[model samples]
Target: MRNILVTGGAGFIGSNLVRELQVRHPEARIVVVDDFRSGDFRNLRGFRGDFVTADVSRLDWNAQFRDEIFDAIFHEASITDTTVHDPYLQAHDNIEGFRRLLRFAEPHQTPVVYASSAATYGICSGVQEESQPAAPANIYAFSKVQLDNLARDHARRFPAWRIVGLRYFNVYGPAESHKKAAASMIYQLYLQMKAGRRPRVFRAGEHCRDFVYVKDVVAMTLQALNAPRSDIFNCGSGQAVSFNEVIAILNRHLGTRLEPEYIDNPYAFYQPHTQADMSRARAELGFTPRFTPATGIPDYLGSLSPS
Candidate 1:
């Protein structure tokens, strides 16, 4: 049987990826390693897999698994809160945790597909590309950039091992309620509309993001793991949409014409725009994002309703 390990499997994207992995490889032995720090255990409900309750930063791999080998490793655990100002904590968990995983993978020559972030391109002017210079505006972005740099070094040292990093843009979908304030703006808007309140936005709500759906993110992640090359690629829809457009889409889906309440922007390090250049991902990993807000909001909102 195939063996796989997913860190942060109780978190939003990680849980979704766990579900997809189970479906695609039914006979595979999937082991989830999560500390339950920012993740909700309910996200893993109905999941058939072994759960290892431990922080990635402090995991004792040898003590738990002994000499068991893994076919692939999905490294998703990290300090993802951008508003957090704790650089030391970010470096310890996000950076040091990855270093530990790399050491584990090196001996096994296991393929690793890890989560990077678009935050690395804090204020890029044009389409964000993998080859462009990294400009981190916050500690969270700095952590991801550090991870990517470490991945590059690992790739060079272990030429035969696959170490792919995906610089994910704004990702949204089901199983993200656990994120709360950290959830996608799309989800935040949905909740506001459900409560009969106007969804709030910053200033004119024109700031754009290349919001890629969770399903697409999962698909691309799998592709990255299986790809022949070890490199970092941008994971996004390759199309930028304004926050106002997202609110409009939510309004249309919920059948409520509620206007967005504009407020003063509080984030001094806010990114005004982001659009992924998909050529690299397409050419390298055969990744094509399948969701846009217009096409995806209805299904997403429907999933939120009580069944």
Candidate 2:
């Protein structure tokens, strides 16, 4: 727990997680791994630490770990966009990277805390629980399901290794700079609104997602890392907010703004009415998210302001 490796540490959630960990464990040195493609360098630039700029899925962890031993590894590296699905690349990165990391951790006994997705719960009617079993609808969701299953099987075989995966809900805040439409819509929409454009909404504006704030996500993630429960937990506020509601919240903060423009569901991939059943996370590991979108939006906007 002293020295940690934050894969995709320069990205949205990982960047914030690293910052939180630095303050909580001030003496601890964090090693950040980022390709900085879809992940931005701006997120990592503010943090004080060493970094490795390379594709995580391709890197040989055994050789990488030969120099230093990581007490914990946060495996956040993955291809997230559903619009751009190259099965070969997705499987290799999302699926294979996990196996490689597991193999590396086999000898060192360093526990892994990796990012799973709420996307994996694609098209579910009710709140998704760890025990309910996942039926992902897209390649992105499928990849995480595969990783979770792989981790489970591997854990059974190698009883010594402890692996944790988090099903992160709609994570949003500063430093989320992914430009793709499928990325954090809140941030993208905010920027668009600030520039006198309305935030686009899904066809019905009825699709709901558990929009968990960045800071809460970071705190819960650290707790999971420290607790080492060796289980996959859903990280979210467990409340659903529709896209229409999100635009209304934005308008309220900015003193009346453009009305949301409805559009066709662009991606043929998957969109679900997403909410998390975080009972397991709260009861077992003592994790409770503090920020709701309504309360979080003002601060989020304030932080992003150039003034």
Candidate 3:
């Protein structure tokens, strides 16, 4: 790939993917597009690439880059806050942004890989598979479901085009500090413990999530660019760890005996559990997640520590 486009390149997963692309394809010219709504420039420190500050939903692609041809396009820009209750804003920004991006890429048939979310599985129990019907509990998740629907429709219309969507589970790592409240639970818990306070979690601390490290998510994303066919795949650690287990992992890494302070889960649509069924990803994309909470937490904490 000689030239690539990464939307939301200043965000957590996008920033990590941008860095990896630079290392893997040193000669390629990367162009990043972000509106900075949920993205932080700090994440792109020392990044050597072209950047366009604009909202993907309202971007005039032809006017922005008249004749630039892209080898691949990574669509990561979206309203990621799950607590957002505004249906119109979520649908317009997340879904419309993707629709416009597809229209821009269709001419070149640029292979596009976009971010989807496991939240689309809603309150489903057990492992989440790609084939399962979407049951989005919030506007944010519903937007992602719409994205998948749009991708499917586009694929059917243009069978020769390549478009892959990845349903990410709970991802946590560096560059996500900017997300603040929307950041992963792992990061939030780490911060609480670091401040010499007991980590707070939903009561009983038994709600489980499949916390996959950002590095693994990026790896899976890069692999998706080389998929033989366009399809959605689950990107996660493939293991379900409870909130109490996460607190234990943090305590072990931080060397703190701080116990979790249980609190009521205020959100009425919270997911109780999520685990990814990665058999499809393994067979199709050769994806093998390298980090679970036990290992990922330590590595992430080490990265945050002073050198």
**TM-score of each model, paired residue for residue:** 0.97, 0.93, 0.98
**Local error of candidate 2 at 214, Å?**
1.1
Candidate 1: stretches off by over 4 Å? none
Worst 10 residues of 3 by lDDT: 264-273
lDDT of 2 by residue, 1-307 (tens): 5898888887788888888888887888898887876788777665877888878788877677686788888888888776657778887788988888788777777888889988777777667788876877778888999999987887787776778888999988877866356558788778778888878877878788889998888888778865544788999988888888888898888777688888888676545577889898998788888888998888798888745
Measured with C-alpha atoms, the lDDT of residue 293 in candidate 1 is 75
| lDDT tens readout by residue for model 3, 196-215 | 99999999999999999999
The all-Cα superposition gives candidate 2 an RMSD in Å to the true structure of 1.9
- Lowest summed lDDT across 10 adjacent residues in model 1 is found at 298-307
- The RMSD (Cα, Å) of candidate 1 is 1.2
lDDT of 2 at 103: 80
What's the ranking of the predictions by TM-score, best on top?
A: 3, 1, 2
* Stretches of candidate 3 exceeding 4 Å from the true structure: none
- Reference-based TM-score, model 3: 0.98
